[model samples]
Target: MGHWSRGEIERAFRDYSHAVVEIGRSSDWSRYADLFTEDAVYLEHVYGEMHGRERIREWITATMSVFPGSEMPFYRRSGTPSTTTEAGSSGRFSTA
Candidate 1:
């Protein structure tokens, strides 16, 4: 994989955030599936793990229907940056 600069990482995250906001506003569940890769894995702390984008989309749609008008906001904790450096020579920071 190619090295990613801090600016590139931040821009990618910003783009992802914008996509999420648009999906929420439109309530377009299919757009949410488009955000993930075909083989992407989704692990919900309370709901267990779901494999594949289709499965994740189904779960998200079902959950959203159950809890209408709910929102998922991504916020960083005070005093902590949104990204953290990983150990080793990767030089890549993991999003919080």
Candidate 2:
């Protein structure tokens, strides 16, 4: 394990949450792509998984266009960035 303190973890969660919200507010799709890992796997119920940033960008663009307007705000259990390890990957997150 790493030598991360409680405070550090808390800060990380907070930062991640803020970053996610920022992505939703951003008009530039390229900037939104920066938040995700290059090879990140996007899990979904209907379309299943989408791997890599390129796919994610395409998906987001299409979706955003369809929706027209609105921000998809992601919140953690206590409004902090929380992971859904059991859902799939080790650091997988749930948008709740």
Candidate 3:
């Protein structure tokens, strides 16, 4: 893996967090899909896993409809990317 500076890691996280909040607020499910790679996998502990960005987008849309006005909380953390295998996996918290 290429070396990533701490600033780069933090900036990436901040950008991701902002995107998530904007997507949630706008209810623009497609935008959510755009944030991930085409083969991205989304795993919800209780809900199971979804493969591919399209599937993840579908899940997010359906979830929003099921629980209207739900909002996901955003958090920021300081850490190196090498700390985990997953990008942007520092920590996540959401509310419905």
Give a tens-digit lDDT track for model 2, residues 4-92: 98779978776776666556556455566677899999886777899998888887777666765644545346434454112233333
Give candidate 1 misplaced runs (Cα > 4 Å). 77-96
lDDT of 1 by residue, 55-95 (tens): 99898888776765755444443543345222234322234
Best by lDDT: 1
TM-score for each predicted model, relative to the true structure? 0.69, 0.64, 0.68
- Sort order, lDDT high to low: 1, 3, 2
> Which is superior by TM-score, 1 or 2?
1
Clashes in model 1: which pairs?
A: none
What's the lDDT of the predicted structure labeled candidate 1?
Answer: 0.67
Candidate 3, 1-96: lDDT as tens digits: 569986887679666766776676676767877888999988988789999999988887787667757554454335533322222453233322
Model 3 misplacement above 4 A: 75-96
* Residues forming the 10-long window of minimal summed lDDT in candidate 1: 84-93
Q: Provide the lDDT at 57 for model 1.
A: 88
lDDT of 3 at 32: 75
- Ranked candidates (TM-score, high to low): 1, 3, 2
Candidate 3 TM-score, C-alpha based: 0.68
